[model samples]
Every structure is written in C-alpha cells, then in structure tokens.
Target chain A: MKKSSLILASAGALLLMAGVYLAFFVAPDAVVRIDDRELVRYSQKIFYFHVPVAETSFVFLLLGGLFGAMYLGTRKRSYEQMSYAAVEVGFIFVLLVMITGVLWTRADWGVWWEWEPRLTTFLVLTLMYSGYFVLRSSVQEESAKARFGAIFSIIAAVNVPLTFVAGRLDSLKPVHPTVFTLQGASMEGPMLAAFLVSMFGMLLFATSLYIMRLDLLRAREDIEYLKEELEVG
Target chain B: MAAGKQVFAIVKKDVLAELRTKEMVIAMLLFVILAMVVFSQAFGVILNDLDRVGGGLLWVAFLFMSMLGLNRSFVHEKDEGCLEGLLMSPIDRPLIFFGKMLGNLLFLSIVELFAVPIFFVLFRLELGASMAGIFLATIFLSNVGIASVGTLLSTISINTKTRDLMLPILFLPVIIPLLIAAVSATGGIMSGEELTEVYRSMRFIAVYDIIFLLVAYALYDYVISE
Candidate 1:
C-alpha cells in the first residue's frame, strides 16, 4: 500500500477499535418492547455500528452507480475499477450489517428474520449486487465486461427505491411490527456519543477498504497487462 | 424509412416470423403449463391455500414464460448476424430496442392470455368477472415493465457465455417491484377484496412500468453496442 493509504487504513482500524470499545464498554443497556406482553433487556450498542454500516453500504453502492455512469460515459477503465471497488466494499459492509442485523433482530424480536421493509430492501440490494458480480464474471471481453457492469450498477441503483417501495407495501399487508423498536427512538447522552463515534469509524473503515480494493484491482490489471506484453514480445 | 416506421417494421417482421414458426409462444405456454401442473401437484394437498399461493404462481409463470420469449426474440438476430445488420442500418438503436420489446410484450401477453385461463382451470380458482378487468390491467402494466427491462438485459446477456442462464439471474431481481404489485393486485382481486384496496399496488405497477420503460429505453443504446 502507498504511504497515504496505509496511514488511512491504520487510522480507520484504530478508530473502529476505539469505536467498538465505546459501543461495548461505555454504552448503556436499555429495555425494549418486543410484543404486547413481553419486554427484553437489550444492549443498544449494536445500533451505533449497525446503522452506520448499513447506511455506509448504501453510500458505497451509490458511489458504484455514480462511477459506473462515469465509466459508461467516458469508457475509461479507471472509473470501472472505482465502480467495482465501491461495490465490493459495499457488499462486505452489507454482509456485516446483515449479520449484526440478524443478531440484533433475534435478540429483540425473538425471531431471526422478519419481512420488514428495510431488511427486505437490503436483501434485494445484496442480491442485485451479487447479480452484478455474476454478470461481471460471465462476460469475457474486458471492455464489454466493464460496460455491462456499469449498466448493471446504474440499473441496480434505480431498482433500490422500487425495491424499498415494494418491500414497504408488502410490510403493510402483514400485521407484524414494521419498525424496529430501537430505531428512531431517542438515545441517552453516552449512547448518542458512542453512536456518533461508531458511525464515523465505520464510514472511515468502509472508505479505506474501498481504496484498498481499488489498489488491488489496479495492481492485478497491471500484472495481467505485463504478462500479455511479455508473451507478445 | 423513418425510425418509427422501422420500429414497426421490425415488430411486424418478428410477429410474422412468430406466426410462421409458432415455437416461442408454444414453448412459453408449455413451460407455463408445466409450472402450473408442478405447482398444483406440489400444493395438491392444500387446496385451501390456493387463493394465497395462486397469485404468486401466476406471476412466476408469467415471468418465466416471458423469459422463453425474450430469449427467443434475439436468436434469429444473433444466428444470422442480423443484429449486426440492424446496427449497420440507418435506424437508431433505441428504435430497434422498442421493436424487439414490443414483439416480446405481444408474445408474452398472448402467453399470459392463454396461461391465465388454463391456470385458473387447473388450479380451480377464479378472478371473478368483476375482478378480471383489474387483474388484466395489472398484468398489462407489469408486462410492459418487465418487457422493457428484459429486452435490454436479454440483449446484453445474449452476448455473454451463458446466454440462456444469465437472463433470469439478471431479470428476476430487477422486476421484483412489478412482481410485487402484480401479485398483490391479483391476490386482492382473487380474495374478493375491493378494487379500492388494491389500487395502491396498481398505481405502483403503473409507475414502475413508466419509470423502467424510460430507463430501459435510454439504456438500450449502451446495451446493444458491438
């Protein structure tokens, strides 16, 4: 890694460690209602990291779309790399969010999964990006692959809101709790501080990971180009 | 010829070709009926739950059947290098996209028309005379939405190595919203619910159709590139 990237990555690592410390050690536990007659004592700690990671995944995917459009317009290989990198980082963050989300859901709701709007929307988004990777792998020619990937990212970006609406509409039909009990409820001072710290830390971690992925892709492309050149020479 | 005329000319040519072969619709109908049979057999014991399951089955059948047509829609062009010819033609790319999309929509609608009635008969369910109009409207809106997106994706995926398999993987997720609305509206009508209750999903379908149609129309140019 380059000097700047190494510094950034280590800084991100340090911040995330600190943030986790804050989340577990400093944050207070709170009681939440799961059903009409039941209450569960839950640690509100996960929300700080979970919400940021989830929201950051959206940002990374959006960047994927934006860079994808740029690649489509310019036909530049670098933009394609950026788009792919953004999606790779976003996909990891999304997986983390899902793991954390499911754990938190199980803790609070006593069930592992619910067809809630946000959860369903994220699931579809993950599927779409997985499809994006599948598309990327299927095409042989480099330029065609880039163009197809770019087109897919753009399409997936558009599908996100539609998926949200559809998921929300489905949620309205079933009589389950549409809202996660802890979400949007106010937090205490230490809880708010920890949430903010973790949120910033997660975003930094996501961006640093994106940079690392981009650098790795670039190096791979360079090595491949050199190999081909050697064969031709 | 003008672009609009060229679009129709391609549509007409495709329709005439389909009329001659009768293969696309036949395959689509056969696939759909097969799916219906499988679903009925699988859900055989639970006759009471057909009302809930039938609408979802209907949309899945439509979606898979449409895939058959969409896959076939590009074969002739790909086989004889007619896609190259079209690209070399004076007409614009979006026009060609519109032509093929319209052709796919027509064939898909025909398959739906055939499959829906057979599905009702095989499953022993009814859309009711009053609910039939709303169900058809939902079908229409969702078909256009799927057709538009499917056309663009099929064109892109056909060039890939796994031509046939890639289309569905890329297609199903994109059309989730349309499927959501269509299945909900169909389910509502089947359950003897008021039209007012289902109108929201219908509106969602209509909006999905319009927005995706526009997106596909614009993006089709990039998708068909050599």
Candidate 2:
C-alpha cells in the first residue's frame, strides 16, 4: 500500500505539472465579449484546475457516501475508515474549489461573491460535509460515531444533486461558466487535453491521499490497542 | 397490520406523554410566535413590507423552532429509559422511526397551524383564499421533509455528548435544500410570483421529502441499534 501510494503520488505530481504547463502554454486564452469588444481573459486559465478539482471533489464525496452505505450494511471497520477518509479528502478539494472559484469570480464577475446556482450549491455542499466532521467528533462511543457518520454521509450525498438543481431556480439565475453543453466539450483540442490530464492527475493525487489517511487511521487504532494491552499487562 | 399497529402505539405513547406535560407544544408555539415578534422588531424598517422576504423570515423561525422540538422529542426517551423499553418491544426498528417521526410531524404541524395564521395576522400580509390553501400545502410539504430528517438526525444527535448543540450543526446543513425550496414556494406566493414557479418548488420539496424518508427508513435500523 505504501509503495503504491508513493508511485501514485509521483505519477500524479508529474501529470499535474505537465497539466499546468499545457494549461498555461497550450490552451488559448478565453475571450469574453463585453459590449462587442473581445477581451482576452488571462484568469480563465484557472478554469482547468478549478473545474478538475471541483469534479474530483464530487467523485470523492460520492465515494464517501458509497463507502458509508457499505459500512452500514457490512458493519466493517475499514469501510467506515474509508468513508471518513474520503470525506476528509473531498472536503480539502471543496475548499480549493471555493478559493480558486472566488479568485476567478473576482476577476471575471468583478464581485467577491454572487448567489449563483453552482456557487450556492457548492456553498451548501461545503456546509453539509463540515457538519459530518462535527457530528463524528461529538459522539463519544466509537461504534455509534461510525454509525451516525455513515448515516449522515448517505443523506448528504443524496442532497448533492437536489441542492444543485434547486440552485438553478429562476431567482438564483444561471451565471456559472458553461463548458460541457449537451453539444459536448466547448473547448479547442489542446485545451481539452490539458483538462483531461489535470483531471486524471487530481483524481490519482486524491486517491493517494485517501490511502495515506486510511493507513494513518488504522495505525492510530493499532497504537490505541497496543497502549491498552501494555497497561493491562 | 402489526407494523401499523406498532407504529400507532408508539405515536400514541408520545402524544399521551406530550398531553400530560403539554410542555413541548406550548413552548414550540410560544417560541415561534416570539420569533415573529423578534423579526418584526429587528427588521423594523423592513417590517412594513413583508412581501418579498416574508417567506424567508417564516422559515428561519420555523427551522429553529423545529430543531427545538426535535431535540426535546428524543431527550425524554433516552433520559427515562423509554428507548430501552421500545427496543425491547417486538416492533421492527424502522417502525420505531416512523412512529417517532409521525409524532414529531404531528407536533410540528400543530405548531404551524397556529403560527402561520399569527404570522399572517401579525405581519398583516394578505392573500386570497385559494392562495392561502396553496401556501398551507407548501408548508405542510416542507414540514414532512423537516420532521422526517429531523427525527432521524435527532436520534443520532441525542446520543452524542453535546446532544442539543449537535443537532443544528447536523440538521441545518442537510435541511438547506428543503429550506431553499420551501422559501421559494412560500416567497413566490407572498410576492405574487407565478403559480407554476411555486408548484415547481413544491414538487422539489416533495421529492426531497420522499428521498429522505426512504433513506431514513433504510438507515434507521442501524441508527437505533446498540
């Protein structure tokens, strides 16, 4: 497990660095028409990383919920640990999405925040997952904590799509950048390549982090077990 | 038949218990009405116009008040060893969830039945009879979402160390989607928005309610089991 994570980490880092280079050099700058004048958006480059990170965050959150439901059914300790770890990793990417999203919005929209649909939904997503950790810590009994965490994760996951759709209400409006329409990828060739590379890189990197966190959690439990044995002996 | 009977028995027990104390219902009523008072005073300048944002105010008050009632619903069971008695009974675990959730729903509805009129009267917001019916229906739909999710979460929260404090943290986030839909539905009505828009929001609320109800039904067994 350790060796694989190290390998995955290096491969992911390499791909991510390549992705950055391609994004900066290969991808054309996005041009927006304001009053019929086309102005190149230098900040549009953040879209590559921002979008990949955002989508990756959704995948991790879905995995967290999947593992959570699995744990409930099987009553397995490892599945619960994976669920917890996935949520933790997913949360970090969500924060990154928010940061990059904010910077991009500031540059493009000229506002620090707008109650746009995707933005509002992501905000709700962040708050919902944050509650998962708080719920975990507040439970004293270990098994009960796992049980409750799993339950909340399942529900929170189910909410992701609902919040997203509700976010598109007429009042919230549709201000988020649209790239992948039903017509398909709205990007040129090199740009799509950069996006795909960054996306796979981000997924691999996140997977490694999840494995490392799971290993650490298991180690902590082992240490606890040893300490109890030592005290008894 | 047996499951229905068992669920009814649990609901009856909670209703009987509440009747004896009349504590939660009265407090919930007072809390909601007082919340409107606070909103009236705090948003004094804006109090004159409750058209655009009145739905949001009603929900803010209702959400907190619902949390208060939800927290209390489970505290007594855990404190008085009633939970053990229920567990010891031959009823299935999911039936217990339905029972407790229905009781919570009943109380929440009763509170809103009174609070909604007081909200309208106090705020002096007027709506036609037909509009009022839709408004009440929207609130009822949202109440189902709240009571179901609340019952499931309150059970989890009450078992934690910081039981009361834990609920809003857990409950509020999960309830945000419902809040959005409910507020939009009610706000649409208050602001004279299109009926189609209000119905769309109501439909989403119903969807949210049904999904959570299914999730709770599937998960409640693990939640209550020792």
Candidate 3:
C-alpha cells in the first residue's frame, strides 16, 4: 500500500507539472468579453487548474457524503475518519475554487464578487461544510460526535442540491460566459489534454491527502485507546 | 387509553411548565420586539419607503425570534438533566421531536400573531394588495419549516460545549433556502405581485419542510440515544 501510494503521489506531481506547461505555453488564449469590451485574455489559463480542482473538490464532497452514509449504516469508526478526511480535503479545494473563481470573475466581469448563482452557491457550500467541522469539534464524546457528524453530513448533502436549485430559481443575476459555450468553440486538443491532466493530478492529490490524514487520525485514536486501557489496568 | 393519557401527560407537562414560567415566550417575544425597534431606527430615514422594507423586516424578526426560541426550548432540559429521563422513557424519540416541534410552532405562531399587529401599527403601512389568507398561510408554512429543523438542531446543539451559540451556527446555513423562499413569498404579497410568482418559493419551502422533517425523524433516535 505504501509503495502504491508513493507511485500515485509521484504520478500526481508529474501530471501537475505537465499540465502547468501545457496551460502556460501550449494552449491558446480564448477571447472573452470584459465590461462590454472584448479583451484577449490569458487568465483563461486558470481554467485548466481551476475547473479540474473545483470538480475534484465536489467529487470529494460527494465521497464524503457516501462515506457518511456508510458510517451510519455500519457504525464503523474508519468510515467516519475517511469522511472527515474527505471533507478536509474538500474544503481546501473549495478555497481554491473560491480564489480561482474570484480571479476569473474579475477578469471576465470586471467585478471582484458577484452574487451570481455559481459563486453564491459555492460560498454557501463552503459555509455549510465548515459548519460540519464546527459541529464535530463542539462535542466531546466520541460516539456522540461520530453520530452527530454523520447525520449532519447526510443532511448537508441533501441540502446541497436544494441549495443549488433554490439559488438557480431565486437568483436575479444574469448568467455569464461559460467556457464550453463561448462562441460555439470547443476546447482544442492541447487545452483538452491540459484539462484532463490537471484533473487527474487533482484526483491523485486528493487521494494521497485522504490516506495521510486517515492514518494520522487512526494513530491518534489508537493512542487514546491505549491510554484508556492503561488506566483501566 | 393508557397511550393517549401518556401522550397528553407529556404535552400537558410541557404546556403547564411553559405557562408557569413563560420564559420561552417572553424571551422570544422580547427579542423580536427589540429587533423591530432596531429596524424602525435603522429605517427611520426611509419612512416614506417603509413599505419596501416591511416584508424583509417581518421575516428578519421571525428568523431571529425563532433562533432565540429554539435556543431557549432546550435550556430547561439541559439545566435539569430532564432530557436524560425523557430519553429513557419508553416513548419513541421521534415523538419527542414532534412534541417539541409542535410546541415551538405554537409559541412561534403566538409571537407572529402579536408581531404582525405591532409591525403594522409601527410602520403604519397598509397590507396593500396582500390577501390576508395568503399572508397567514405563509406564516403557517414558514413556522413548520423552522420548527422541524430547529427541533433537531437544538437537540444537537444541546450536547455541544457552546450549546446555545452553536445552534445558529449549525442552523442558519441549512435554513437559508427556507428563508429565501419565505422572504420571496412575503415579498410577493407585499409588492402586490401575483401569487403565482411566489408559488415556486412556497413550493420550495413545502419541499424543504417535508424533507427535513423526514430526515430529522429518522435520525432523531440516533441523536438522543447517543
């Protein structure tokens, strides 16, 4: 397992390096409108790393929900740990999404923040997931913490779609430019390659981080269990 | 006969206790009235346009009032450790959820009933084109959503170190969709817009209420037992 993880880690790094090169020098800059004026933009470059990482983060969020449901079903501590790790990794990626989204919004909309659907929903998602961590930390008992956290995760998962739907229906903001639909131009070969590489790199990164965190949590739990055993003896 | 008596006993105990102390009602009412006063001060300069902000203020008041009431509802159980006894009872955990949610809904409705009149008098704004029945329906449905979700959350928060503070932290984000729906519905009524325009929001609230109520009911056993 260690050998496999090391391989995955190195592959993730290598793919990321390749993606960076492709994004910077290989892919063409797609034209975009800024403030009703057409601008040839280079930060369209951010999309390669940005969209893939954002997509990966959402995948982790759903994985967290899946593990949460599993934990509830099996009453296993390991599943809870995996769910917690996924949420942590998911949060880091969510931060990246927000940062990259801000840059893109500024480049395209000429505004730092817009209460648009995607951005607003992402903000709410970030908040909802952060509350998950808060809920876990606020409780002291291990069983209670696990139970509450699992329930909350499932509830948050259920709400995520409702939130998206609500935002879509309620948002008065106009839909902005999207990469897939810009002038009916599809992603060229190099751009598609870079996007896929970045996505694979992100998936690998998330996997390693999840395993590392899970190991650390298990170690901590083991030590706590030993202490309890010692005191009982 | 025995089951009916026990359920009534639980309900009567809660109601009698509430009547005697009036802590939950008074605290929630005072908090909401204070909020309204603050709103009046904040919007004093816009008195001419008070109608525009009136709907928002009404919902804001309800939101904060619900928060306060939710926090208070569990205080007695936590203070006296009576919640442990309740959990040990043969009655199902979901019943506790329903009992508490119904109690909260009753208190919240009472507060809203008083608040609407006070709000109208303070703002001196007519109901305009709002159908009174629609407005009442909005209040009824909104309270169910709040109480259902709030009951479970308050239970979760009671076990936390922050207890009261954690309730809103854990609750507000989950409840935002409901709030948006409510505000839009109220806004539709206030703006003299067609009810059809607010149907989407109302439907969303109904869906939210059903989903959360079911989830909370299913999960309440795990929550109280552990």
Model 3 TM-score (2 dp): 0.91
**Rank by DockQ (best first):** 2, 1, 3
Q: Best-fitting candidate, measured by TM-score?
A: 2
Q: Where is model 3 more than 4 Å wrong at Cα?
A: A33-38, A174-189, A229-233, B1-9, B128-130
Ranking by lDDT: 2, 1, 3
> How well does candidate 1 match the true structure, expressed as C-alpha RMSD?
2.7
DockQ (CA atoms), all models: 0.75, 0.76, 0.67
Q: What would the TM-score be for candidate 2 when compared with the true structure?
A: 0.97
User: Tens digit of lDDT per residue, candidate 3, span A1-233?
Assistant: 46666777888889999999988888777777889998788767878888888888888888888888888888989999988888888889999999999988898678989987778778888898889999999999989889888888888877777777777666355475566664753676888888888889989977887777788889999999999999999
Q: Score every model by TM-score.
A: 0.93, 0.97, 0.91
Maximum-lDDT candidate: 2
Please state the CAPRI-style docking class of candidate 2.
Answer: medium
List the candidates ranked by TM-score, beginning with the highest.
2, 1, 3
